[model samples]
Target: MRLSNRNKTPFYSFIYSLAGIILVLWLIAFILEINKFDVLGDKSWVLLFIPTVMLLFLYLSGRPIFEYDSDGEALNFRNCHILFLLSQNNAKDEFPKYKLIKYNVVNVLMFSTLYVYVSSKKSNVVILKYDLTFMTKKEIKDLKFSLNKVVKTNGETSKDDNTVID
Candidate 1:
């Protein structure tokens, strides 16, 4: 199975584009006036500054397009910012399904992260983090289902192989 947020790319792109337009308009207005209004006019700089800061924050923390594939023996995951131009935190991972031990999803404020625990050759467990902020509720549900299925299979296989009949 393969899952991705490519379908919503246009929507996210539009939002960022709109924010950019607003930031530009505010800059132009501020430069033209410099000092014009008489009410809250002295603090008009606030109007220009607030949106600029907000846009910056949104861009920095913007949602990334996420992709997951479980078609073969290995599980693949990839994440890259919707606006790839300024994308700095792109992440990708591929590991065998049998290595998957457990997974957890943490939601804080407006961000969600997926923590995958896998057994490594040298280490008992390795943790991998993936951003899930952009995934829809249904997508998240399906992802949880897939992870749970993998964990359950791992547990059952380990149990069966370790059992000794006398």
Candidate 2:
């Protein structure tokens, strides 16, 4: 269950591209205002602050947020779920020991949209959009089914009222 990925290079690249675009736009604006310093108005500079904050947020969010163990436990972003079990029982043969789940930008966008839609309807499931790219759609669905089965099996055993060993 260990999730491994090529270090955050690609993730960093995406962030850099996003931030660079914002920065370049800001720079161009600044350059254009070189001669007309006051043309942007005192409050005009405030506009750049939005992008600055957004850049910071993007940088922070883009960092690796989860790492899974071979045992199926995961260390989620913020590490509160370090002990949380993402899967039950170690993976069997033909299954990868570690799967790297990177959240693709497109998936992130979709997740965000879905989150908003679901939340508006007050759905019980809290969908966290981070690190969603690591697993393909099929893989994610399969993992969910497997974990549910494991939980159900364990739950039934715990609920049994009487058990005797010969």
Candidate 3:
């Protein structure tokens, strides 16, 4: 199973573009004095904060593009921010299916993250994290089901390996 937000890229990009346009319009209005903001009077600077806050909120909620591949013998995960050139933040991980021990999904306000634990040769466990903020509810549910299936298979295999036959 492979899941990605490749199709929804346009929608997310439009939202980001809208925020930028709003900020630019506000800046132009403030600089040229096109219209007077009577409510803010002497503290007209507060109006600029609205667009800034909107940009931040949208970025926090929709910046990352997540991909998960559970094909073949390994699990592959990738998370790359939409504005990759600006932020230069990307995470990628691949590990054999048998090494997967457990996983966790944490949701906080407008953000979400997935933590995967894998058994290591030298260390007891290796943890990898992926961003899940922009994933839909159905995607999240499918992801949970995939991880659970892998963990159950791992447990069963471990049990079989530990059996002693006389």
Candidate 4:
């Protein structure tokens, strides 16, 4: 199965999108009122950063996706299962940082709707969260089984660098 958790039309996402837009608009209004369109003061400029950071947070944490393909030709690997993140930081193409086997553990932290957390090998503890939906009960069991097998088998070996998608 091929799936991406991104809701392109965020209008249906309701709370999240509404919050983002409302916050951004409020910030813009605040800046306009304070700065008077003359010159943005230092503190007012800092206020400008709030909305930008909020939007970035919304973008990054908004849509967590899970894509599974038993057939790995699309993913560029034939047999092994790999985990990677596709980022939209770039304007043209998505920048992926799943290389170098930076992550070590994959744990199903929350059972309801299945929140999968991927953490790095280092101590700073960067975690990638996947909020998965659209999966059937049996599929979730199979997914849990497969991910558990990967964790049990790998155990910080960092062989994940071999994972790829073409």
Candidate 5:
């Protein structure tokens, strides 16, 4: 089944607006500085270097991958890893038997990024590191609901099929 393309996040637009403002201001400042400084008179064009690099990084990192499905399991994700996997069985004892989620967020400016993960059977709290931006509150809530539904429906269907085998 195809997931709906509904973004309920109220703050996403605001955040994007803020980023735009910051980028614009930075570019203007760079231009004004070039006019006053003769230090790089021969290479004043370097003033546009920083903002150009930033915009390029943002464009690459912001590409969104929203859905994944394989072998009867499916996942709906946002602002996370480009690739992921889901399964009902775990080879290790420490691994829990429930939905597993993992993703990486690349932070270009800082020269660093973070990987985050969650499990449905464990506490609702997420495990994360590094300073990474995420989807708005509403988007996260909706994504969680969608993932939970996928897991529940798959589990129920498997149970019904197993009963017939016995």
Candidate 6:
């Protein structure tokens, strides 16, 4: 399924993150000013650089993004940053991001909480619901069904009863 145009993040999240960062930086600069420390005196703009860089990184990364297509027997997702989850190989473990836990614990307008289970016996990946905010509602449902079915069928699931998440 394709992501809807409406899947883009609300403007407030950016405003919130930026505003919070800027406010904290301004506070720090103000404190320094009280100490007769000219924050801008020695290319200390670099001090300001820290939060500026952070905001840019957040702006660039706050958007959810993914490109997917079928790879014969498996799905190939390019730049699936959450899991780096794509490959030509059909092995259940080879396709990268292992599982979409089949259980959505929480979902809200500002955020969501999905307990994604990666089957890798190696490194771990950490992700937040914000990462999936770019996907449309239909796309999210389709993905939940697709990934849960795929992982369950692969026999990686530990539960005896299917009890798939809806």
- lDDT string for model 3 (53-72, tens) is 99878766644688999999
**Model 5 clashes, total count:** 0
Model 5 alpha-carbon drift over 4 Å, by segment: 1-37, 41-46, 64-134
Give the Å error, residue 144, model 6: 1.2
lDDT of each: 0.84, 0.42, 0.84, 0.42, 0.46, 0.48
Candidates in descending TM-score order: 3, 1, 2, 6, 5, 4
Please give each candidate's TM-score.
0.86, 0.42, 0.88, 0.35, 0.37, 0.38
Clashes of 3: 0
Candidate 3 residue spans exceeding 4 A from truth: 33-39
Q: List the residue pairs that clash in candidate 1.
A: none
Model 1 Cα lDDT, one tens digit per residue, 1-166: 7889988889888888888898888887777666564455577687688778878777656456889998889999888787767677777889999999999999888788899998999999999888888888899999999888889999999999999999
TM-score of 5: 0.37
Off by over 4 Å in 6: 1-61, 78-106, 112-115, 123-130, 156-166
Writing each residue's lDDT as its tens digit, candidate 2 over 72-160 gives: 43222221111124323222122221222212224454231111001113544333333434334654455445444444554565567
Q: Among all windows of ten consecutive residues in candidate 6, which has the lowest summed lDDT?
A: 83-92
In model 4, how large is the Cα lDDT of residue 100?
18
Candidate 6: give its CA RMSD in angstroms. Answer: 10.4
Model 4, global lDDT: 0.42
**Predicted candidate 4 versus true structure: per-residue lDDT over 81-124, tens digit per residue:** 11123243211111122321232222343223333333445654
Candidate 5, residue 87: CA error in Å? 32
